[model samples]
Target chain A: MDTDATYQAPSVDEIKTLLTERFAGKVNVTKTETRRVYATLPKEIVHEVCEYIHEKLTFEHISTVIGVDMVDYMQVVYHISNYHTGTMIELTTNLDNHDLHVQSISDIWVGGNWHERETYELFGIIFDGHPKLERLLTPDTYEFYPFRKSYKLRGQE
Target chain B: MAKDVLDIKAESAVMDTDKMWIIMGPQHPFSHGLWTLKIQVDGEIVKDAEPIVGYLHRGWEKEAEARSYPKIIPMADRLCYAASMTYTHLFCMTVEKALDIDVPEKAKYIRIVADEICRIQSHLMWLAAVGTDLGNFTVFLWCMREREFFMDLNVRLCGARMTTNYPRIGGVRNDTTELFDRDVMRCVERFEKVLMDDIVTLIDDSSVFVSRMKGVGYLTREQTVNLGITGPAMRGAGVDFDIRRDDPYDNYDKIDFDVPVMTQGDSYSRYQVRIEEMLQSCKIIRQAVQKVKALGKNAPYRLKVPSNVPAGRSTVRLEDPRGESLMYLISDGTDKPYRLKVRSPIFTNVSAAKPLVQGCRIADVPVVMAMIDMCLGETDR
Candidate 1:
């Protein structure tokens, strides 16, 4: 086991500044709370932004990927965590209704593979270049994306 | 006899040999829950594997979207029966964050006590599963025996044993019952002794148990982090992070406890991490109970918040027994949440089944997988 005794993790401001400097206007650091950073990124630059976070910032883990269906658009939320600093960055990306597609980050963080698969199955979001972007936790035969807001509950009209 | 044996070997050598895929669950005893593991095996060795979950999905997340905030408390209780309080507590915490209200001091201490108790109960259940998976009924029986005391503790705190819907949005359901602190201290002290003296001795002294879990299912610290594993499993792999300590919430920062981490990235280390965690939880329970008592009985345990949450987003993560479980809430200024997403620990941990079971013998599959401590309730949800 290697001890990280000398490793110094940058504070939240440093991370925000680093990201804003790298991605410029493409990356927007919306909110910064205790041990948490909320950022919004356009779908076009998600892949590069995530690569920078993983490779440079040392955010080792991807906590989860959540897909939400808005009436007019779609959203993908990625929670990335850096254990060294105990800080989590919430990366939210907006997708147009016509193109519910985004680059897959499974190559950078292997854990995102299953989460992408789940998002694809539930919200019909296509994760381009994902290793196996198939239905997960849902039957392949099930045609409908049950999680979409348009899909009504069992008793609802 | 030598000539006949040589003839038989020569004939058998010409026969075709190929890898076979064996599906192991959804009904198999090796799977503690409703899930299947399809393992590709060449003779006794597993070359690759796939885990299929969701037999119990029941559309939990979507179901939550339709129900009101308070109505989902009992539903959250059903997320994982083994450690229901943690899920409910997590759900309530997320809502409270959206509501932007702080629970009273007494409620925070009580939650800590309840959460620690739930952690012990969940770990004990996992230990029992590990025992049975490793072919030792005695260990299973003993663990279940110890777990029953915790279940009784749960009953004393709330009213239910398995799914104790004790945590409300602003606070817990109620304050500690009469003599609840006394009962918890007694149980924790007795359990500490039995676990250290009897259970630890039985497993540590037995060479069979030691050898079975010592080196099987190895994962490096990098792999553990990259694969998004958390909780004790990640701690065992040498990533020193615990949400309770590093990312404190709900008076966790106020409490003092040590997060047990093992550098060895093997099954045995994972087992040892959980065992040490149970002991640490005992220490936490003791301190938290005293804090609850210090606050006096008049202290408020539950706060009355508004029926509707403000339109916003709140995300909260807690150190669950299995791993770091997170809940993300999106409210639309209504009683019903716009979206409720649960990131179950087992959901990600089980995704690494291919790496976890690969390269091990078929017989070792159960023992190795047991270390992840499968729970379909939360995984499917």
Candidate 2:
């Protein structure tokens, strides 16, 4: 009980290899920084990837979700962390431009509920299986996707 | 009026008393910020709590896309008025990473000093709020009296008292003086003697206070991580995880301090964790002050960089007084940021309240919430 387990965060390359070996070309992995590992998986495997990281890799918490409107398609970036290993993984999945929908990982991480809703409202990207998809920060009557490229700020001049 | 169309129940003509929806804010005494807690109550017990934020949302991310890189520092300070320095420091660090600017060694120590000081300030403010939430008016008075000490130190270090846009992109706005160091140490000493020793004993010894806090707001260890709870709240659940000790940002790795953790996972345990954390913050400052002093008084505090920042996307996360705050900034070779996404700690912490207070009694809601130490500015941002 007394021995504090000293954890050294794994290298990005190691995580890349681990994911590649596990998924076998189903996903693309890249390293933005030493501590941050970015993996771009298909929309179909988003929930699987989240479950793998949460249950298997022990990445206990989803830090937050960031949605970007990349013109051609919408992208949902998930910042997940494993407290024990002190590793951060950024998982990105693209959504359809016309539909702007993808699978929700809320059940994988209960904390993802509000984050998914925020993404749904701000970027207009829908989480397919979210229990309740509604506006969080914006007013319920307000119907603008504020984070999208189409929505402009008040003082843009 | 709410149930005008519903089938009539015995002795109830207008509303049903079985399961009622109660909007607990925007201006309620229980809510500290301009947000509502829609708690589904069945008489004395709370069935559910749905935290509704956005009452004070200013669309900071949308505004950041138009503003230049350096101008966002002041805006960040408003994210959490109670812990302005922490928010500003996280924002500066994010933008600095995007620009790849090197902060001076002196500035590194100074930023840590400012951050830990804000930790003390925030904890004291929460202490006062917690006291006010409970019927302990004396605790509020004593806490405000003690908070003035650090607020004085904050103003002395930075010109402004509360909204301190002190930490800049590269370093800080200015260097702190030798007198600032002396004043910080003096205040910390008095706080340890007065608040940590005397006031703590006065509160902890009260059987009523202890009984009220203990065994209330039970969040299991697994539930905490699953719900993304961090900071002192997670520590109270017996999870030994602190970003300072684990991540070791700025000069935290150089300093020696223990991450205070308790296993009770209740309001009382959270109270103890924060009180202990203030003492630890003071300890960190004690070491950080010496490190800053050893660097000599005339050492450079901030660095000079170009007016226009380079284009890149970078994100940085740091431990806030409540939990973790992150700023993800994207630049596109322009003076202004392409996009800036802020993941304020309270956003997730407050969201977790629904699950945490699921089966808690109606009376325990305020106690549970005050223990969360929410800042609506941060949550709604």
Candidate 1 on B120-190: residue-level lDDT in tens?
99999999998989889999999999999999999999888998989998888888899999999999999
List the global CA lDDT of all models: 0.92, 0.84
Pairs in clash, predicted candidate 2: none
Tens-place lDDT per residue, model 2, B82-162, is: 999998998888878877877888899899989999999999999999888887888999999999999999889987889
Q: Give the runs in model 2 whose Cα sits over 4 Å from its true position.
A: A1-13, A155-157, B1-17
- DockQ versus reference, model 2: 0.66
The per-model DockQ list reads 0.79, 0.66
TM-score of chain B of 1: 0.96
Top TM-score: which candidate number? 1
Cα lDDT tens digits for candidate 2, A1-157 = 1112222344566667767777878878865565678778988888887877776667888888888777788888889987865678988788888877788888888888888998888888888889999998898997778888887666653
Model 2 residue B159 CA deviation (Å) reads: 1.2
Error of 2 at B225 (Å): 0.7
